[model samples]
Target: MKRLKYIMWYTGLLAISACSSERIAPDGETEQNIDVHLAAGISESDNSSRSDNNTYIKTAFTTNDEIRLVNTVFFNTPDFTNENTIFTYAGIENNKYKFTQSSQNDTSGNPDGTGSTDDTQPIGITWNDFSPTSFVYMFEAVYYPGNELFSSVPSDQSNVENFKKADLLIAHHRMPLEDRYKDIELTFHHAFAMVKVEATVPTGVGGLPKNAIQEASMINVQTAYHVDYTATIQNNGLRTVKGIEDENYPRTNVKMWLQSITENTAKKTQTYTFLGIIPVPNPNDPNEPIIVQDDFIHFEVKVDDKTTKTYRFVPKENAIHLEQAHITVLKLQLGKNGVLPLLLSAEIAPWTQASAGMILDEEDPTDNTLSGGNSSDDQQGGNQSENQQGGTEP
Candidate 1:
C-alpha cells in the first residue's frame, strides 16, 4: 500500500509541477531560494506545554525569493517487521490449499513479482497472529515561488526577510489510533504523533545586492504564541502487541478542527479542519489496494494590523476505518500581517467495525451435512436405528 501512495504522491507532484507556470528570470537578477533547518526538542520556556512526554521539534525555512511554500508533513512510525514487502502464494489446486511461492519476482525475472493471481494460484496470504512492533514518522516540506527570485540562491536581504516571515511552532500529542482500538477486545493501543506548522508570515525587505552596505537591521521576528496538540493510546487488548507495518496494520485517521478566539469581536469564531489517514497502496502492485487519499482542510481569514485573530481546532468524530489503507491531508492558510493567533487542537477516534471479509472463518458446522459419503447414506437410511439398537457408534 505504501508503494501505491508514493506513486500517487509522485504523480500528483509531477502534475503540479507540469501545470505550474514557468517564471523567467530577469536579465541579471538571481532567483531567490529557501532552505529549511529542523531542530528537535523544545526550548526551556515552552517545555511546560509539552504533552504525552513528547519532545518538541522545530523547522525553519529561509529564502531570498517570494515563494509559495508547499509543506507536506507526514507522521509515519516505521514498521521494523518489514511488513512493507507484499507476500504471495502460488500453485493452488483448491481454495483451501496453495503452494508458498515468493511473489517478489516477475516473468521478466525482474524484482516486480506477480501480486494477487487467482488463476496461476491463490497468491496473497497473511498470518492470522501477527502484531505491530515499532513506529516511525516522516515529515516533508516543499516550497515553490511564484517568481524567479526563488529559483536560485536568494540575495541576503531576501534571505533575512524569509527567515523573519517563516513560521516556527510545534504540534502537541496527537495519536493516530485513539478510536479504532476503543471497542476492540484487544489490550494493545497504537500511539503516534509529531509537531507541525502553526502559522507563517512574510518579511517586508526585498533582495539585497552582494556589494550593498551592511547596516544593523532588526530582521529577526519571533513566533508570537505557543501551542501544543496531544493524544494518548491506551492498551485495551489482552496481550501486548507491537506497532504494525503500513501494509499489514490498519490506517490511523486524524481529524483537527480549529476555531477563532480573540477579543476582536467582529468574527468571534471561525472553524478550520484537518484530517490525516494512512496505509496508502503501493503503485507497483497490480492487485495492490486502492490509494487512500489524504483530506486537507484549509481556512483563510483577513484582518488588519489593529485586529488579531485566534484560531483553535478540535476533533469532532471517530477515526474512520477501512478493509485496506488510505491517506488524509489538511492545511490552514492565513494571510500575512494578520495579527491573529492560531489555536489548534485535535482528537482521534478509531473506526468501530472491520470491512467485509476481514473476519476469520465463523460458519456454523451443525447445519452442514455430507451429500454422498456413507455418513450421508446412513442418515438417509435412518441410520439412527443402529444407535437405537445399542450398536457401537463410530
Candidate 2:
C-alpha cells in the first residue's frame, strides 16, 4: 500500500510539469505573442535577442502611425465674377453739344448759350458707351493648411507623423484688355462682366475639415473716359478800338495780355507740370533754392464784335473732362469636408443711360438730325402722356 501511494503522487507531479512545459498557440493564431511564460523567459535570454525584438516593434508602430496621419488632402476656391457690362465713348461730338447745352440750363427750364447758369451741374460721362466693348470674368482657386496630428513620443518620434498637415494650392485665370477691344474708355456706362470659380474635393483621401472648404465667385464691370481741349491766340485786343486810337484806354489790359501770354509760354515750354510745387534742393543754387509757383493756364481767343475794323485778337483757354462708372457682383460658398455648403452674396452697382436715337433708328434715315429730333420728341411725348395718366416713367 505504501509503494502504490508513492507511485500515484509521482505520476501527478510529472503530469503537472509536462502540462507547464507544453507550448500553447497564441490567441486566434494572431502574430502577436501573449505567453506569460515566454515573456518571463525573455528576461533570461541574451541581450541581443531582447534588443532586436524591441527595435522591430517600435519601427512597426511608427510606420503605422505615419500612414494614418499622412492620409489627408486639402482644397479651396477663390472669388470670381460673371455677367458684366461695359460701355465707351471717344471724341463724342453730339455728347459735347448736349453737355454744353445742359451746362447752360437754369432752374426755370430756360436755356442760355453762354453756359453761365448757377443751377448747372457738370455732366458725368462714362467711357464704355461709344463703341463695342468687352467684359471680362475670371475664376481662381486657392488653398490653405488643414488639421494636423502630432506624435506623442517626446524625442524618438517627434515628427514621424508630420505629413498629416494640409497642403496649399493656387490656380488663376487672366485676360488681356487689348485683345478684346480696339479701343477702351472709362467714362459713360457700366460694363457687364462675368467670372466664375469652381472647386472640387477629391475622394479616397481625408478631405478638408468641417469648416475649411470654401468657394467664392465675383463680377466686376467698369468704364472710363478722358476729355482734353486746348486753344491759342496770336495777338492781344487792348489797343486801338475800331481803328481809332483811344488815349483813355487803360494799359492794364495790355499788361493782362502779356501776363496771359507769358503763362502760356511757360506752360508750353515744360515737359511735365506739377499740380502743386514741392520744395527741393536746387543743384545749381545750393545755398538758396528758388521757390517756383505752380499754376494752370487755359487759353481762349475771341474777336471784338464791337470793334469789327480793329482787327483785335484774344487768347483761347483749354479744358479737360473725365468720367467713370463701375459695377461689381460678389458671391461666396462654403462647404464641410467634401459636402457642398450654403452660399451668400450680393449684387450692388449702377445702371447706365441708353442712347435713344441709336436704339430707335436701326436703319439709316434720309436725315440723321431729323431722326434724332423725332426720337427726342417721341420720348418727351411718351413721358407727358405717362404723367397725365398718373403712371410712373422709367
Best-fitting candidate, scored by lDDT: 1
Backbone clash total, candidate 2: 45
Q: What is the lDDT of candidate 2?
A: 0.20
TM-scores of the candidates are 0.16, 0.13
lDDT accuracy of residue 143 in candidate 2: 18
What stretches of model 1 exceed 4 Å from their correct place? Answer: 1-248, 257-264, 267-394
RMSD to native for every prediction? 34.6, 41.2
**CA lDDT of each prediction against the hidden true structure:** 0.23, 0.20
Q: Which predicted model would earn the best TM-score? A: 1
Cα lDDT tens digits for candidate 1, 73-191: 24233222232222222221221112122432334433464344345543322221223223311221112222222211111222323322222221122213322121111111111
What TM value does model 2 have? 0.13
Candidate 1, poorest ten consecutive residues by summed lDDT:
355-364
